[model samples]
Target: MLESFSNININLKFTIENEKNNSISFLDITIKSQNNCFQAGIYRKPTSTDNIVPHDSCHPQVHKTAAIRYFANRTVTYPLDVISKEKEQKWSEGLIQTTNTIGNLLKPKHNNKNDPYKQSGVYQLICPKCDMIYTGQTGRTLNERLKEHFNDFKHIYRKSKYSTQLLGNKHPIGQINEIMDVVYVGNKGSHLNTMEKFYIYKETTKGNQINDKNTVPTNKLFDVVILQ
Candidate 1:
């Protein structure tokens, strides 16, 4: 025999299983209607079945569907509150004037408006060991420019292999203890390439008998350029 609620309307069935003691045992179960289909537990003798019966109600199985629905509802409601709070905090902090200045400094200026290269000063370096002349340019103050080079000169050293190899492996600009002479070729808004070439040639060939412009020893290596 089997039992179920009147509204549920489960159908009943029975089967017989032969026991080891020669006595026949009856198995009864219910079938439920599911989407115009039927489903039921398998009919077998309780003694012959080795499978463990589940508890009357498991917490996870009972609550899983409702838990998922609750979390889904919370996800929809909570993200808006989080975003609103974030916006409020950002508004309260406001924008700093120093932040604006820093932003302007980091922004890239297009050469279409004005030539950035022309508005920067040029630098020249002579490797005492190789007699190789290098040219460079910068918009930052001299001390700041030199500090930047010292901080990140490995990248430049890697690129200018010929210059580093010829200079007896000396550190670029700042690492060397000895002071090297530096001359300002020209102010901002000028042909930096021409100015650098002219001054480099002039200084290198001043007392020497090298009359040929092409024969002057120039490394043509640039380490860094810091734009304002």
Candidate 2:
């Protein structure tokens, strides 16, 4: 049973229209027949608090307006009559105007990301005898990853480029503490890829990068940071 299903967020609801109900509410719209024509209008559950990502919050602008975009999209896409459409528009305008109100404070995300030993982010492994360095990211702890690199280099396995490239150049590979350093801490995913690339780019600019060049398109955001 555990393998077959889980009920974490699977909600069950009865949407069947009863004798007293003329409209069916589905998702964000209400649908019903008027005269001889079928019509649909925006719907909001009574429990809706009209809350969204506030403008004053420490988050990306796009993240703040994502809900607003959805509201505008629904207002344009739904078959609401002029009156209902105007009401939704006014509601959306009010919501946007009130977004400047700050709510509970949240600690800056950097507070957590700065912990080097907590794992998951870009790291650098340097050759003991050369200026070259290998930058990489992993979801696991840096200690574990660095140990893996050391073992791979000692065994002459081809799994890691850091191992093969360093030893191939007749360089000595030391234990994790002697050669590895945590560069930036971040969670796993494509975000790590960008963070890893940023460090690699830095190393390459200094003529010390040992990794192959990446083909990911140039990120304008990275350029803005580097130019400063």
- Residue lDDT tens for model 2, 29-138: 77777788767778889987688887756899999989999999989887898888999999998988763321111111233534565576678888888857888888
Q: Write the per-residue lDDT of candidate 1 for residues 1-228, one digit (tens) a residue.
A: 323343355453443444433233233322334466543322335463221212223456545345344434443443234444454334323421113332232223333554332344555444545445554555654445445444445455533323443334663443332322334433454554444544445544454221234633654321111122
Candidate 2 global lDDT: 0.72
Give each model's whole-structure lDDT. Answer: 0.40, 0.72
Q: Which stretches of candidate 2 lie over 4 Å from their true place?
A: 1-115, 215-220
Per-candidate total of colliding backbone pairs: 1, 0
* Model 1 spans with C-alpha error above 4 angstroms: 1-120, 152-157, 160-180, 191-193, 203-228
Q: Which residue pairs show collisions in model 2? A: none
Which one wins on lDDT?
A: 2
